[model samples]
Every structure is written in C-alpha cells, then in structure tokens.
Target: MTVFDDGERPRGGGPWPIWGIPLVLSLCGLVMIASLSLRNSMTGGSPYAQIVKQCVFFLSGLVLMFACAFSSLRRFRRWSGLLWFIALLLLVGTLIPGLGVRVGGARRWLDLRLMRFQPLEFLLLAVPLFLADRLDRSRREGFQGFLRPTLMVTLLSILPLLFQPNLGGTILVTLICLMMHVENRGWRYPLMGGAFMVVLFVSLVMIEPYRMRRFLAFWDPWSDPMNKGFQIIQGLVAFCNGRLFGVGIGKGLQEDEYLPAAQTDYIFPAIGEEFGLAGTLFLLSLYAVWTIRAYRIYRRCSNPFLSVLTLGLTMSIIGPMFINIGGVTKLMPLTGIPLPFVSAGGSAMLFMWAKVGILMRINKISLGEGRREREPEGC
Candidate 1:
C-alpha cells in the first residue's frame, strides 16, 4: 500500500506543515537572538547589528532551502562524492594559517571576508549523501561491507573534525554515520562500531586537558563555580529566574553579562529566561512533532537511499538539539554545540534549512509520487 492516498497528500506542492515548524522556530529564534544580544549590541555601538545579520542569514537560508527542495535527489546523489570532497578540503583549509580564522582558541572557520563559515556544518549533509551513495553501490555483506564505507567516512570526515578540536562535531558526525549504518546493516555491525566509537571518544577526551575539564565540570560544577562552573551556574539561574512564564523577552539578566555565549551555545537558557518554562516546553514540542514527521517519512520511503538519508538528516538536527539543550540545563557537559534553528550561526542555519528542504522533498516523493519497488541489488 502507498504511504498516502491522493487525497491525503500535502497540498500546494510541498510539505507545508513539516516545513512550517522550523520556520516558526526560526522566527522565534530571531526574536530570542535580538533579546539575548541586546546588551552586546548596545555595548558595541549598534543595537540592531546582530539581529540584522541574523535576518540576512535567515533569508539566505530560505533561498537555499527552496532551491534544494526543488532539485532532484538523483542529482544530489550523483554529486555526493564531489560535495564530500569539497567539504573535506574546506575542513583541511581551516587549519591553514592565513585562511582559517581562530576564535576563542579554536580554528574552525574559513575567513570569507563577508562572513565566516564553519566547515563541519557542510559535513552534516555531505556525510549522509556520501554514505547513501556508497551503500547503494556496495554488494559485500558482513564486516567487509560495513568496514569499507565506515572507514572511508571516518578517515575523510571524522578525522578533520577531531583535529579541528571540535569534539562535539566529531561525536555528532560519528552518531550520524552510526545511525545510517544501523539502518542499513542492522544491529551487529553498528553495535561493534558503537563500542569502538565509545572507546575512541573517551581516549580523545582524556588526551585533551580542556575537554577533560569540561567533562569534569559536568559532574561537579560547584568545584570551580567561579571558573569552569560559571556558565552552567548562570544557565541554572536563568531557568530559575524564568519560573513559569519567563522574565518577559529582553528583560532577562543572564544575557546582559552573566551568561557567556548566551546567543549561541546557551541560547536555550536564554529562551527559558525570557520566555519561561511554558515557552520552553512549547519550543520542545515543535521539535518533537517535527521529528515524528521525519520518522513517518522515513518509514514510508521505499528507496533505501532515501530511507537512510532521512534517518541521518533527522538525527543531525535532533542530536544537536538534545546536546545543546541538555548542556544548558546541566544535564550534560557543555559541548559548544549550537541549538539547531535557534542559535546564532550562519553556516548552521543554512545547513539546517537545506536539510529541512531535503526532508520535505523526500516526503513529497514518498507520499505524493507513490513508491518504487526496486531495492539496491544485494539487499
């Protein structure tokens, strides 16, 4: 049976409802960014500068989303390798002295003159596309089938992320690959891969003093409340102060100075401080609903590539969302990962919208156009 009958198909040529949640969340993000950055903007001599930039990024993201939504999946799959190669080059280029911009001691952005772009964000799409393409071609079974593609992705993608010293990005990319692998290869290969990943992640963390410090902070923020614990402490205070309905937008004290990285990493706390617990729950509900929709689309997709693609893309957004939110709430260590759709980062915003576009396109293909019965050769 088809996933959706003709009458149940989305109207107006797109998955408007699926696309609508991110649109609303992003708009909310703009308001929150404006509120959270008000003090920084004032101190910098332009009260509206940050919000204005965010507006430009949001609009630009919209354009990219529309373009990707209308494009053919076959074309995307065809160019997957090229896109992945370009992404790796960008990742390596960020380590070059004159080309990469260092901010807060980490070199992760390419100096584009107009704006800085994070190369890891490109991996959000590239890794999934490349994996889908590889899996489509591979006919081997068991360890060889999984190991070949897994090793290729790890070397080309995850290695760059770790050297960037972005442990969070490394973890995110690893999880994406794991999810895709599990979907295609089932529990055995993925379980083995997961164990290997865990050991690697812990060893990497132990090797870096700063990462160790962050991990330690997660356990006992009070041990160094004045230093390592400050951000988490302030984040907690933001939630406490927010109480029920929030302190009312722009009225919160955390972003004025107490909370560092308030507009980016800790934006979730800022939302809690201004919009209150109710608003926070509402925001999370939007994410939950959006995720459910993505899963539904995944189930209905008859194409293996599209099915795995959907899973990876969904995790790409949801994984970071949980990490960011959990970090701010002291449920996990601060990973310096931005809250998807709500944080102030141009590259992240653009990639997120593009993913949304791809999901919508997949939904359209699965539901409206009907399913194809063909599966990849070996499977």
Candidate 2:
C-alpha cells in the first residue's frame, strides 16, 4: 500500500517494511554487543559467552516479534490484564530475597532457571498495553471516562517501578502513561498530575539523602568525583577520548578497564569512544527514524487504544536512548539506564523486541493484515 492511502484495511495481508527497521537495528546490536563483550568475555572465561547469549535473546525476540505481529490486538486486549498481572507478579517476586538477582547495586532481576530477567522491562511494555486496552473499552461505552482508570493504572504501574529503584524505567513508564492520559482525557489531568508529582518527588527526595546527592551530582559530577559522581566523570573521559573519528571498534580504552559499568549503564560512552562522533550521529539518526515511523503509525491507527500503545512503546525506546546517551555526554545527569538494543542484558533486549512486536502488531492490525511481511516490505 502507498503511504498516503487511507485504507486501514490490510489488503490480502500485504507486505510492509516496518519489520526491517528493527531487524536491521537488531543486527547492528549483535555487532556492538559482541565487540563490547570481547574483553571481559575472552578473559573472564568463555570467549563467545556474551555473544552466544545475545544471539539467543535475538532469536527469542524474533519469534516474539512475528508472534505479536500476527496475533490480533483484540486477543491481546482480552488477555492484556493477565499479561500485566503476570509482569507485576514477577516485579514483586524480584523483591523477595533469593528470587531477585543483584548486580552492581540494584536488585531488579528475577533469577529463573533458564535466564535472569528484569521484570520492569516486561512491565514497561505490558502496562501500556493494559492501560490502552482498558481505557479504550471504557471510552467506547462512555462512562465517567478515561480519568479514573488512567490514574489508577498509572499509579499501579509506576509505584512498583519506583520501589525497585529503577528510576529511569519509572520515568519512561510515567511519561508514556501521561502521554496516553493527555491523548484520551485532555490537558487538565497532566497539568494537575505534574504538580502533584513534583510535590511527591520533593518529599521522596528529602526522605532519601542519596536522592538529593544524585540530583546535585547530575548537575556537576566533579563535585563528588570519588563517590556519586564517578560514572559521569568516566563517561566524560570516554567522549573526550573520541574527539572526532573515535578510537576504533573494540579498541575502547575505557572498556578495557577505566570506565565503570562499561557494559551496562555506561555502554554509550564505550560506543562514543569506539565509534566516534560520526558513528554516534548515525546511531542517533536510527532512533530518529524509528521515532518518526512510530509517530506515523500512531497517527494512522484507527483504534485509539493501539495508537496510545504505539506511542508508549515508542517513548519507552526513545526515553532510554536519550537518558543513556545524554547522561554519558554530561548533557543530563547520570541515570542508570541501558542503551536499548546495544546494551548487554537479556530482559532489556527481550522486552525491547516485544515492544517492536507490539508496534508491528499494531501496524498489522491497523491495516487489517494477518501474516507479517518481514524485511521492511514497505508500508
């Protein structure tokens, strides 16, 4: 189908190029993932361990993407609550000792027999679908409207996220909720909500002295270089090292030893060091294209529920990209957020692909298609 066509109906389940974007992006991720892990993986034990795991996650994600693409949104609506409920169960499970895996400082992952997974990642994707599904149904019948359910869903989703100390994920989830709320309920809710959030945040910050330190450090990391400020300073060093062309892939000095959290929160700095300014721009451009495509899909969606779902998923991806990149660049304070596809984490990659699945599904459903036309068949 042509770009301008108003046909919401998928013609004989025609092809679309949407899938290719994420697929190609995922391949780029594989390359970066391998390179980033080379130093640690080779020396620590197995030479190909991280690469193998990443490949596993990529394969799993590909399966999920297609499954979601062909699956009806209506079916998901019927089951969305259950999916979200399962996600919440996992989140709660993580807080239990022996259940949650602690790496660095946060206890955010659930240790399963097969794999360690971050429940918050699934929550990020599922909560949006759950809210959209419920709100859409409520609006259709014309009750008191989206306000009550929207507020409840937002609170329910975000409360657990915050408690996990996953601030970056919490912010992303909250912003997406706010966006859907505004789109459905109007501007008044967000304005009032924003005011309330500031008051709440200030209270929380006061209760936790570390939060205040983090805030101050975000502004200037050198103020406390040895403690709360270390990550940002290391990130700055990485970028400074790669003034123009970069040190070359897998040749990041920081990744070899200096930079802390090299494979996780500070992954972008490693990218900046190895890929340079030009490569960083190209990475940013990929996200920009993804953002534009996402918005276009949201605009074209006939179902209001799916439109908001698309928007939430898009924001989920864009939010982390910005926070991680900006934090390392010192443009924003350091937030322990992973660089979406490129980061070395199973759960993050899995849910990220799940969001892609949702995006692909929404576009498929919006156009009334059945089979997914892989390889960017051209929307």
Candidate 3:
C-alpha cells in the first residue's frame, strides 16, 4: 500500500484544489437567503437585515476558514478536549432560564447579548476532533476494547441536546459519531450502537406527543394541512410551482408568508420555487462535487487522525444538507436541520467554513508539504 510521507507535497502542488465548489455554494446561499428573507424583512424590519447579517457571518467564516487552513493540526488536536468540554458547558448553559433564549418553543441558543448561537454548532467540529483523538489512541485496542468508552462519551454529549429537544442536532451528532466510530472500529460496534440509537430515538419520539405528531405529519401531511402540516404543504407547493426552471430569483410567491422558515430550514424549497428544478439540481451537484472532493482528499491522507477527521467533517456538512432537503421535499420528516452552507444561521456557517478550512489543511498535508509536522510531544 502506498503511504503519504510528511513534508512531501501532493501530486498537485497548490493550496486550494477543491475550494471553488464551496465558494459557489456559499454565494448561492447568500443570493437565496437575500431573496427568501425579503418578505420577512419587509414586515416592520429592514429588507437588508438578513442579507447583511449573513454577509457578516460569511466574512467572519472566511477569516476562520483561512486560519484553520493554515494553522497547526497538532495544536487543534491538543485543544480538542478543552473545546469539547466548553461545548458541553455551553450546551448546558443554553438550558438555563436566563442564559438560553427560547425560540419557537425550543431552548437551543445562548443569549450572548450581541447575538445568540446554538452551542451544538461547536460540536459539529469538536465532537469529531475529540473522537479522532480518542479513537487514534485506542486503535491498537480494537473496537470491543473502546466500545464502552465511546458509548459513554457519546451519551454524555447527546443527552443535553435531547433535553434541548433539538431532534435535528441530536440526530446529526449521533450519525456523525456513528460514522466516525464505524470508520475506526469497524462495522460491528456502530451496528450495535445504531440499533440502540434507533430504539432511543423512537422512544424519545413516542414519549413526546408533538414529536409523534410530526412523524405522523410526515406520512400524510394533508391530514392536518391547516395546522401541523402547513409547512410541508407549502414546501411541496413551492417545489411543484417551480417544476422545471425556477419562477426566477426574487419572484417566488410562497416566501411571502406562505411558507414557514423560507429562509432557514425550508430554504431549499425557496430555491426550487424561484430557480426551479434545474437550479435545485445545480445546487445539489455542487454539494455532490464538494463532498466527493473531500472524500478524495481523505483517501489520500496517511495520517489516521486526519482521515477520521475528514470523514466526520464531510458527513457533518453533507448529512444536514440531505436531511434538510429531504424534509422540505417530504421525503423525510422535517428535522428542522438547516441546509448546511445554505441556511441563514451564523453559528452553522462559521463552523462549516472552519471544517472546510480543516479539509484544505488536510489536503495540503496529504500532498506532503506539511508531512514533517507531528502532534505535540504531550498531546
């Protein structure tokens, strides 16, 4: 088997091989968010509010991405544990009465005065890093040897998310963890863990009447079209209205109070409504190419930690896109997962950009330029 060595440059001797795809996606997101948010902003608010905020986030994310791309992976690994702990603290803090602001009935964001953010966003990167570190240490012990500790850590991290009732975040994190575990420990451990997760997920849904209603709504939304099913119905209508070519950017009707979360969870439908099916496909293709490129870099990585990190980060970005799109199209229950790079959320955008940066760093390392770098002596 061929192994990539430290300090050796990849066959392609440049810094940004697959950055264009994400850049296009991000730009598309900004355009779509601007269009979709117009209606909401017109109602006693500045029309430019959402777009401006997203732009600020986009610029900030760019800075973070570049920092991550050029920073030391070893330094990242060293601080992974502390980051995970801080993430947990924030998650817990979000549940506190004064600290966590309630929106639409869910307490998922910390009130930072200047802005609120979901702590779970940090986990999108932290959990994977923490797991990479743990799994790398236990690579010699086999899956069975590390299974218990893995489960314990996963449960600890996910339990708070469950309390926040962030079904989407919980599901995303669980899936990412499972994928990472399977990659390092093989299929057996995750298969068992997956089964347990299924049972737990079902139980959580069953225990909550609202969740059960959401599940039922997914199966036959027409049953409660005026109430619980309104969002899905509007989403379907948006897609149907944009059958081939989109109605045209800024021309879609559903976003004007007809579709809920038109700028966030259901933004994909907004894109479909305005840009049409062709546009949606174009966006999906971008995602597909971006994910494929990330996987290619992963395949070329010789570092076990980098490989695991890449896989987890790729899934974290792509998984939510699929889930959000599926939910909007009624292919799956609405999980309230924002469409990764496309959604109007600062925290998600920031971390996602950071993940992209990490991928770029890994790509550079794989090429051999950063091969001589090693983890800190004590890390």
Q: Write the per-residue lDDT of candidate 2 for residues 60-95, one digit (tens) a residue.
A: 887887787766666677788999899888887877
Pick the winner on lDDT between candidates 1 and 2: 1
**lDDT score of residue 357 within candidate 2:** 78
Q: Rate the local accuracy (lDDT) of all candidates.
A: 0.83, 0.73, 0.83
Kindly report which residue stretches of model 1 are placed more than 4 angstroms away from their true locations once superposed.
Answer: 1-14, 370-379
Instruction: Show how many residue pairs clash in every candidate, following the order shown.
Output: 1, 6, 9
lDDT of 2: 0.73
| Residue pairs with backbone atoms closer than 3 Å in model 3 (clashes) | 6-371, 7-368, 7-371, 7-372, 8-368, 9-367, 10-367, 246-275, 246-276
TM-score of each: 0.93, 0.88, 0.93
Q: In model 2, what are the clashing residue pairs, if there are any?
A: 10-367, 16-377, 16-378, 17-376, 17-377, 17-378
* Candidate 2 all-Cα RMSD: 4.8
Worst 10 residues of 2 by lDDT: 370-379
Residue-level lDDT of model 3, residues 1-379, one tens digit each, is 1222245433543445466777788899999988877776667788788999999998999999999988988889889999999999999998999999988788899999888888988988899888888877774555554465467668888999999889888888888888887776667777888898989899999999999999999989999999989889999999999989988988898557788888889889889999899999999998887876776787776667778888888888989998898898888889878888788889999998999898888887777767567644322
Ranking by TM-score: 3, 1, 2
The TM-score between candidate 2 and the true structure equals 0.88
Worst 10 residues of 3 by lDDT: 1-10
Worst 10 residues of 1 by lDDT: 1-10
